[model samples]
Target: MDINCTTYELEVLHKIADAADALKLPCYLIGGFVRDKIIGRPTKDADIVCIGDGIELAHKVASSFSPKPYVAFFKNFGTAQIKIPTPSSEGSDTLNHLQLFEIEFVGARKESYQQTSRKPMVAPGNLTDDQNRRDFTINALAISLNKHDFGQLLDPFNGLKAIQKGIIETPLAPDETFSDDPLRMMRAIRFAAQLNFTITPATFEAIKANANRIKIVSQERITDELNKIVLSTKPSIGFDLLSKSGLLQLIFPQMMLLHGAENVEGMGHKDNFYHTLQVLDNIAAHTNDLWLRWAAILHDIAKPQTKKFEQGHGFTFHGHEVVGARMVPKIFSRLKLPLNEKMRLVQKLVELHLRPISLTKENITDSAVRRLLFDAGENIDDLMLLCHADITSKNKHKVKKYQQNFELVRMRMAEVEAKDHLRNWQPPITGELIMATFNLTPSREVGIIKDAIREAILDGIIPNHFDAAHTFMLQKAAMLNLYPVQQP
Candidate 1:
């Protein structure tokens, strides 16, 4: 089968073939470039494998370009790379306007791994050996770049059929493949999630059998794969596979805790695990933000921890949001995720996930809306999206009622925001100003006055204007039997 190639790509391939010919070496375009081309996916990198010295061939190819691209060669790995700038459609000279495409050259080689480590011993080998070491069949497909057969596909493993069938199967025996490099297990799930494909039954069972081998892999690598899965169009597919394959229990026991629901006195709650997945998928439908999806994944994470059954009440997870928010940092640290603003965003969302739901249930008030705006600040919209996705009841009427109430709350929020202008709002009075006005040191009285002013504004007893806050501050200070040292 022939793969479609753009004019520029064909020119680059010809140059590579010319270089290999000059060196009397055989070369082919292999792996993701070939696979993605067949599936009509946009790819930015090309992998070229040659039977002779890949670094030498890469240097030769680089010299053929007008402005020779720099060649970065790794002698230990027998690989080299060249990044060439693709002229913009408008042919702008601005550096930012140009797109760079990476071409990686590697020599065909075989690998053997010891039982204790994922790192494999490498040696120069033939094309068949290189294909044999591939993780999956679809990824093993190759296209010859030789002048004799410019775009000929080499598919001894029937990888093209697997691509057509939408299947993810190891090129070799699944057990041997996974046992050699356990990280491939995560790659398998990632591919399944990305392509929305199915893992063959035999391949899946092999993953389950070798799931424990994942321990040998580093946390950074594991979390990298996990993030890719989380960013897929529908992430729940990957998580469900992880759970069924027993990898979730090993990698993330906290999520596993959300799996089962219990009964007490003929009362039971919906399975939090499935509910979390539904919320994730719902948020996925609305936004592609990775942190927001993470918030959905963790919004109800503490339900299992805080679950309680009372005699009259069915189930109560009164403080799950608070608990879950507190759990975010530790989970992120354990998973080797970023500890900066991204973690803070997820934590803040988890803490406030229930605020909009509570507003929907209660009488909509300006005070409540103002408080939510102040607390959520810039993330109010995201918080609302989370709350909307949180409405996952089986009863259609109940869901509709909640949705209608949410709309009412949203309308009220807009009115209050337009009138009060309280998004990311702070009180007009400052503690330092209060202290300065009262001729006092940093003390409890200053804190009390600041809190009073803030509460008065949010409670609608005073306007957010400086004059109203100043008057309220003076009134509270008088009540405290204090007088301003200076008059304005």
Candidate 2:
């Protein structure tokens, strides 16, 4: 009952209360807004559940705001949203005092799902009926915003006990709850990962039993949950649960493929699946960058496909990088991820993951360092984080050695970056300049010359500047027997 409300939130609730009173309707502040408030996490989004028309409540609520926030009403779904600025950053030199907050209002409803589809048949219902349909107990908590019992907590399912126990359990029977919508099973695990909570034995078993029903859910919805799991603090925990509960194979068979190790000739490779998770957890510690964390999860994805046992030399994955790079596009497309630069960055990291580690074992040349800087450019730091995370050996000494070597690599990068400035670094000689210099337009020779210029810069063969690149270009052009065009 002791849920603290900020001054801004109090203002929001007062407006909402006024709106509900004007229409003579019952409404409650529910779900995430209530859950987050009790947990003391910062939140600017509110979910208001009204017994009557949610769209009309949203309109009335918007009218109550000072500037009359826009109400985006959806009649078919009985949902509406109003956005307002709510400041959300901390520092001396802060930006945006007022941040954009979203207030979504939906009618209290009960849902029944058919066996074949994930969509539920929804209709207006009483508060208890609405609470019964909640996916988990913790999410079922609601606060009254009506005049008589304003800010009163209503948790019939003892959601507070579940939150205190750090447990994820369904409000209703686990079997029926998950059977109605298998996506709830995923939501249970996702909540466990996000909240770092435990799934009770009954709930866990229900998920395992109903795991196969995940196929009925759309890939986008499934991947959205999968991504949330991947982005958690300890993603491996959720993924391991997904594998154990037999849900992963149905949803993400590719990741499931990384589960085991094969031994041949008294030698073997580490289970890539566990290794990938360790890398993900490690990257999570250093950054909250979601895409960078994704790169860590996928860094060694092609090891299984490229695995082969070589005599005496043991196991080798010769082209896993290339194979993994090739697999990225199809995987992204199938998984409903953006096929833009984010995908490309992941691909580049997978291909280059082993390079810095490989460098650590050798004399560690300047040319190699330059190439890495040039290839990685701005992403060099993230690549290093992934490389550091990739050191998941059981040997403490091996881990220490890898960490030490990474520090050296980072120091070397500082040196190289200072000298060459290759990050977002472009070659001084443009392809167009090369074309004009050699009196050619769009030929294979121009491409060859361009590659050579880039290579020379990456190889530390010359200073990364126009004059040096020009001199190298002329020499390379001479070797190709292409004469320079005279100035007109």
Candidate 3:
């Protein structure tokens, strides 16, 4: 009640307070729910830190609702959670489809840690003890839900003032805090990026000093935090902080390799690291697709390895797109990211990012556009977006010129796609049909004919039709000293 809540939210809190009163327990809304509400950020999940048995309070609260909410409790962790369904909208016939309000209940506890693992040795404690264990001051703010101080705000660590100033600071000494749970370091940066806040100088310095301790955390947890950073409105902030803190080298060394620019013969290239971040920001402004943003991040990942300075050209990352595509799987594997279709989408975008831009510079050809459409397939638009974002030239006129060229490429694609339908194009002539016509098994001749037919269609030599491809197939077959057998 200390923070503004919707009518339904207040009702749920009143129920929780009623339940706690009946049980003779002190309960408070704590953690992100309190912080987000105070900062005017929309939040659904709330954490209830109770002075007594949290699981019992959860069950007691669940019984108050009409359709009893299920109390899922983990005895080992002494925590419980319930998701209360939203009341149906007025005059609606169907069931409530809105997201349930998720509340996690846990007894106030103090924690001690070992050098080997972040798994804490826990024991029951008071609210002050629990607040002392929070990773950041902003997250430690709580709202009392007891009868005596139901709407009272508790900012024991001056969390409200920290929130007001938009700063991230740990309640305890940051080194002790981070060493106890190294994941908190990642969380600190993530909050900074998410809230557009600054990490207190001392806290940030502690993060740098204990950056190596991040190795003790699991890859999955690290990647999870990294993904949160990437999904934030301005992810470059987080990555920059990570790089400055030296955490990037430990957690993702491949990206760290992109940190510097090199100079040769009085010619230097733009720093690929900052260039990548600019591209990421550019793409983020256009789309919230995480994979597309990831594509922007990795579009130039192989630049460091492929960097070359020709006699005339200052710097050239020749074939970097191909090399970057090949590196995607390895990066994905190391980051503990999903190696499924999502990763493939990012890989495809990274590989094809240069294709659309190349088209903009040259005399646009239908065949070239068709090939790009075919290669990029369903992801053509996304690939185009990534390419546009990749143009990080600081010259305003140069950027404008490149964008105009990109517009031309997009127009060409539209024309070619409408006429040829080459997006996600499939070859009209199949290897099986070629083999059957030539009366041969799966041999080199079949593959040769199939490739030729596909190239012919992409080149606009033959219409994308089975009959034209069939005739073209026969003509090419004869050139190879092969003839189709007579059919019945």
Question: Model 3 compared with the native: what TM-score?
Answer: 0.96
Worst lDDT window (10 residues) for model 1? 88-97
TM-score of model number 1: 0.95
Residue 39 CA displacement from its true place in model 1, Å: 1.4
Better model by TM-score, 1 or 3?
3
Tens-digit lDDT track of model 2 for 1-488: 46777666687788998999999989898887788788777777889998999999999988876678888988899999999876354322232436777899998998998889878999889888888998999999988889999878999999989989999999999998988999988888888888899999999999998998888888889889988998888888898889899998887788788888888879988889998888899999898887888888777888878888899888898988888888888889988999999999999988888988888888878899998888888888888888888889999998998889888888888888899898888779888888888889899999999999888888878899889999999999999999898998
Summarize candidate 3's per-residue lDDT along 379-437 as a digit string, tens digits.
Answer: 89899888888888889999999999989898888988999998877778777788888
For residue 131, model 2's alpha carbon misses the true position, in angstroms, by 0.5
Q: Give the 10-residue window scoring lowest on summed lDDT in candidate 3.
A: 86-95
The reply for model 2, stretches above 4 Å from the true place, is: 87-98, 264-266
Q: Model 3 Cα displacement at 195 (Å)?
A: 0.7
The residue-by-residue lDDT of candidate 1 on 43-120, one tens digit each, is 889999999899999999999987899999999999999999765543444333267989999999999999999999
Evaluated with TM-score, which candidate comes out highest? Answer: 3
What's the lDDT for all of these models?
0.91, 0.87, 0.91
Look at candidate 1 and give me any clashing residue pairs.
none
- For residue 85, what is the lDDT in candidate 1? 78
Per-candidate TM vs. native?
0.95, 0.94, 0.96
